[model samples]
Target: MKSTEYITVTQLCTQYKVTSQWFHKLHDTGLIHITTVEEQPCVSLQAIHQVDKIMRLHQELHVNAEGIDIILNLLEKIDTLQLEMNSLKSRLNIYDTEQ
Candidate 1:
């Protein structure tokens, strides 16, 4: 992966004003994926957005890690379903145009 594609754990914690413990907790719970570079932990840039969302759910909504996990899973499912729905609609449109 490109170096630009991931951010160091230290950078994430510093920017987000969260602790290393928080990062470890998220990683341990499988809420975020961490890659090691030169024996240092790094997080994907894509996963940063998810971490932000999780932080909001925890800080603003007072959701626990388990609750956040469930919410994220549900959100992912909804996104997947929406994509499938859009694909099916596009296929239907093609058929309609053919008719």
Candidate 2:
């Protein structure tokens, strides 16, 4: 599929070997965002990675939906903090060089 293409739920289910009900459960639990395309539910390619992570957390780690939600939120916060740290380091370097 093209990079700009949105994948349908059926395509995701077929590729991941999961059921529609499972996908719906993930959607309902806010683990994944489902977009509507031509009245059919679809997922973006960018979200595919998140879906995979959720699957790993569910199947491999046996995490429940609530736990997964917390894990994902923490991960996102970590990412944000890392980015902020990098920006701060860059600013510090600039100030140090000017002094």
Candidate 3:
């Protein structure tokens, strides 16, 4: 598909100073999603932040792909729980006001 919101895998590799294999590893581990367009693999603009995070964790923090996967999973859980807690707190406040 013709879209302005995606960067090709080759472009991402060069821009991020990482190898194509690295991106493949990330994809294999489910850390990032890849879409193939015009027979070329690309990532969406919305996932750039996540891609950067994965790279930083691997390059700077020396985390492996598996480690990155675990870290990401934990982060997702934390965010989900935080949202649930906020929702519960709002409901509790409403009940308190009714008392």
Question: For this target, which candidate reaches the highest TM-score against the unseen true structure?
Answer: 3
User: By the TM-score metric, which is better: model 1 or model 3?
Assistant: 3
Task: Find the 10 residues in a row with the least total lDDT in model 2.
Answer: 1-10
Tens-place lDDT per residue, model 3, 1-99, is: 576778899998998798999999989988889998878899999999999998889889999999999999999999999999999999999999998
For model 1, residues 1-99, the per-residue Cα lDDT tens digits are 677888999998888788888888888899998899767889988887788898899888988788899999999999999999999999999989997
Itemize residue pairs with steric clashes in candidate 2. Answer: none
Candidate 2 residue lDDT tens string, 10-68: 98788777788888888898888888877778888888889889888988898878889
In angstroms, how far off is 40's CA in candidate 1? 1.5
How far in Å is the alpha carbon of 35 misplaced in model 3? Answer: 2.4
Each prediction's RMSD to truth = 2.9, 3.4, 1.7
Q: How many residue pairs clash in each candidate at the backbone level? A: 0, 0, 0
Top-scoring candidate (lDDT): 3
Candidate 2 wrong stretches, greater than 4 Å: 1-11, 14-18, 35-41
What is candidate 1's TM-score against the reference? Answer: 0.71
55: Cα error in model 2, Å: 1.0
